[model samples]
Target: MQVHIRYFSVYGSTQTYAEHLAGLLNTSAHPLEVPLPDDATPVIALSPVHGPVVQAATYARKIQGRPVAVAAVGMTLLDVAREKDSLRKLVPEHVARFYLPGKLEFSTMSTAHRATLASISTMLRAKPVKSANDKAMIAAMGTDTDRMDFAELQPIVQWVQSLR
Candidate 1:
């Protein structure tokens, strides 16, 4: 059971998670890219999921027909079953999925990401009272915040190990 670790991170949380997993698994962590090793080696991809983007999907497309496990890093939480359903069409149906909480660094984001978040925050704040979900989004995107915890990776690591 050979396993490979790969990752794509915009703000470094995903990379950190991948590196930790790599260390624990004693494997190398590669950045998600083409020209990957041609083998039946299963991949554990640590990627971030933003508003409408999920980095793991790109890797999944590139490695079609292979066993791929996705560890999604994000700031928001959603029902795992529902999230899996939403991503099923983009990723392989057999993919093993995991959701890991992520952090936000306003200063580290691209101008476009910052601008887009700001726009959404503005809209959310316009309403005097926000729903819990909206408020959570606003707070996460509105300020520089860190919620990353290595402990959060335990389940993902255990799951990946089992794949081996």
Candidate 2:
């Protein structure tokens, strides 16, 4: 079976996971910006979950007719059920889904993200009340934090192996 891996990462955690997976699968992982190959092969896509949304879902329409599997990486925790629900809009129901935790380096964020994080931090710090999510985000306001683990990739590996 032919496998094509496409991924996008901001801080490189997802890219790391993608590379590791590609290494094991013995396939090359390309950036999502590159065009999907012309043949109908299984596609393994890795993208960071920004707001629990797959950032690379925008590529779904371009990859129709190919079997697909997705891995969503994020600093925030999420369950597979929610991910499945969100992923249905992006891929067919036959598409497999996986979630992996990723790190967020405050210094490595883009300007727009940094500005947004700063605003949220300021609001949460100034306000007497904060929601659980807000509190979590506030508590995580620091540089060089990591949650990614290589062992977390077993599900993805199993999915790919099943395909093979």
Expressed as tens digits, the lDDT of each residue in 89-155 for candidate 2 is: 6766677867787888977788888787778689878888876656666788866668788888887
Best by TM-score: 1
| Model 1, runs deviating above 4 Å | 78-85, 126-129
Expressed as tens digits, the lDDT of each residue in 1-164 for candidate 1 is 56788899887889999988888878778888735677887888878887767888767766765678887787765444245545666677788777777788887788999898889889988998887767788878757877677887677667766766
Q: Candidate 2: global Cα-lDDT?
A: 0.77
For model 2, the stretches where C-alpha displacement exceeds 4 angstroms are 78-85, 121-135
lDDT minimum window of 10 residues, candidate 1: 77-86
Residue 41 C-alpha lDDT in model 1: 78
Q: RMSD for each model, in Å, please? A: 2.6, 3.0
lDDT of each: 0.77, 0.77
The weakest ten consecutive residues by lDDT in model 2 span 76-85
